[model samples]
Target: MIPAGFEYHRPADLASAVGLLQEHGEEARVVAGGHSLIPMMKLRMAELGHLVDLQAIGELKGIEIADGTAILGAMTTQHELIEHADLATAIPLLREAALQIADPQVRYLGTVGGNVANGDPGNDMPGLMQCLGARFELYGPAGTRQVAARDFYESAYFTARADDEILTKVTIPVPAAGTGYAYAKQKRKIGDYATAAAAVLVGTASASVAMTNLSDTPVWSEEAGMALANGDIEGCVAAMLAAIDPQEDMRGPIAFKKHVAAVILRRAIDSALSRRA
Candidate 1:
């Protein structure tokens, strides 16, 4: 289906993109990879007067690691994350999770910013970002501010980012030495969204656990992480289950999804613990 006609603007920089968004207001939508928005537009679910494309903004594309932190530009593709030698060394869990997102072809086109900014519970990055305790950088007419990944999502398709703000980068503190991480996802087939998934990061000083496709937004269970750290797997699982509000879907019934979430999360936790240095 063809999308409704809309004016397209490719801004050369972040300020211009934010200005376009401000000019168009709620009538404009910023598109990165177009993986999520284009389909909605085609379905007439999203009608916009202006489509501000950020692809031309050179500042919104790259990866940088410094001062024990990694800054990933919003346009960084999954394939780029997988191919980045230093990034993989610094955070192998990112590569592990990126590999599980869609397929090779989609990975080449799907932007990490698109994956996390939209508050789509099924997208892999949000949960992983929560587990990593990442921060999102937003640029707008008001200048810049940061939002913690844990506080970014308010609901499905809703995030802390204002319509006039563009998410420009994601900043994550590098996992400390001896940190271990794993992303476990269960799906019916390749390219399918996870029926249930978990991302876990266990370090010498702290741990984080987050779940995907378990609620309207990604579920970050700090309680569960602490339980796991205290050596109570069952308690951790119970905490995780208590944190999510899974709904019935084509993937399976609510009970089945809960079961899958439990099994996958347990496996991810165990795997991460084993890999801990």
Candidate 2:
């Protein structure tokens, strides 16, 4: 199927992009890397009168790290996440996870913002951001507001972003020195979405755990994380098992998914534990 015909826009600034959305209303959709939206449009799952392209906006593309913080522009590609030496050093979990998100071609064109903003549970970034305790910055006619990554998703393919707002960047507080991080994803093959994936970060006295494709939204169990911090591995896994609600699909039965989620969470926790100094 072909996407319904729509006018294309290239906005060089955030204000211009916002203005386009205000002018066109809900019929306008923003395009970043086009890896996700284009497919939806072709399937006619999404139809719009205006397609606002953010690629021309310099403010929406870049990576900056300083003063114990990292800022990634919405248009930054997955490949950029994997390639930036500074970012790789500051947040190695990002690079590790980005490497597993589809193959090279998709990663080259997939933007971090699109992956997270679209509220796709299968994408790797949302869960990882939750584990990292990152925040997303939104821009619109009213100006900018920030939402914690852990609180962003409302359900599958849905998020806190409003119709008139654009996600401009992601802000992450740099993890304390020597914090351990691991991203573990299991799939049938390369480029396939994770059947169950876990992101874990262990600090000296704290921990964070989040899972992808285990529920309608990313699962970040503060219960699981607290249990891990206290060194009760079983308790942590148990809490996460209780928190997730995976449905039966091509991946496997519900029982099998729960088992896989348990295994993956443990593996991620162990990997992170070993890396923690």
Candidate 3:
């Protein structure tokens, strides 16, 4: 299926892109990587009169690590995340999660910002970012502001990002040394969305547990993490199950999803615990 006709603007700078979005207002949609939006457009689920392409904005493309934090440009591709030596060293969980997102081809083109900012529960990054306690940087006509990953998603295809705002960066505080992390996903096959997935990080100071494809938004289970810290895997899994109400879909029935969620959560927790330094 072909997307609807639309005026396209490829802006070389963030200001120009934001200006285009500001001028076009609700009729405009900013596109990065096009992995998510293009499909929606082709299906006519999304129709935009003005498409603001962020690809040409060089400022929105790079990885920087400083002062125990890693800041990734919104346009950084999944492949880039998976391949970066510094990022792989700083946050192995991110690379592990990126490797599970679709196939190599899709990873090559799918930007991290597109995956998380769209509020797609099935996308791997959102849940992982939540587990890592990442923050999103949004730029708009008003100015720049930050939102925590845990607070970003409002619903499917809805987020804290305002209509005229563009997600420009993701700021992740590096997991403490000796932290244990795991991302466990149950999917039908390569390139398929997770039936149920879990991302767990256990550090000396804190722990976070997040689930994917289990609800309208990524489910962050603080209680589950606390339970795991108390050395009760079953209690942690139970807490996680109680936190989400997964919808029935091609993945499975409600009961099946719950069971899968339980299994994956258990596996992720156990794996992370074993790796804890």
Per-model TM-score, in order, reads 0.98, 0.98, 0.98
Q: TM-score of the candidate numbered 3?
A: 0.98
Best by lDDT: 2
Q: For residues 1-277, could you state the per-residue lDDT of candidate 1 as single tens digits?
A: 8899999998898888888887878899999899999999999999999999988898999999999999999999999999999999999999999999999989999999999999898999999999999999998899999999999999998999998888989999999988889999999999999999999988776789999999999999989999887778899899999999999989989999999999999999989999999
Rank candidates, lDDT, best first.
2, 1, 3
Question: Local distance difference test, per candidate?
Answer: 0.93, 0.94, 0.92
Cα-based lDDT at residue 179, candidate 3 = 94
Give the poorly placed runs of model 2, Cα more than 4 Å off.
none
Tell me the spans in candidate 1 whose CA falls farther than 4 Å from its real position. none
User: In each prediction, how many residue pairs overlap at the backbone (N, C-alpha, C within less than 3 A)?
Assistant: 0, 0, 0
Q: How far is candidate 1 from the true structure (C-alpha RMSD, Å)?
A: 0.8
Candidate 1 has its poorest 10 consecutive residues by lDDT at 15-24
The residue-by-residue lDDT of candidate 3 on 75-132, one tens digit each, is 9999999889999999999999999999999988899889988888889999999999
Superior by lDDT: candidate 1 or candidate 2: 2
- Residue 272 in model 1: lDDT: 95
Q: After superposition, how far is residue 267 of candidate 3 from its true place, in Å?
A: 1.0
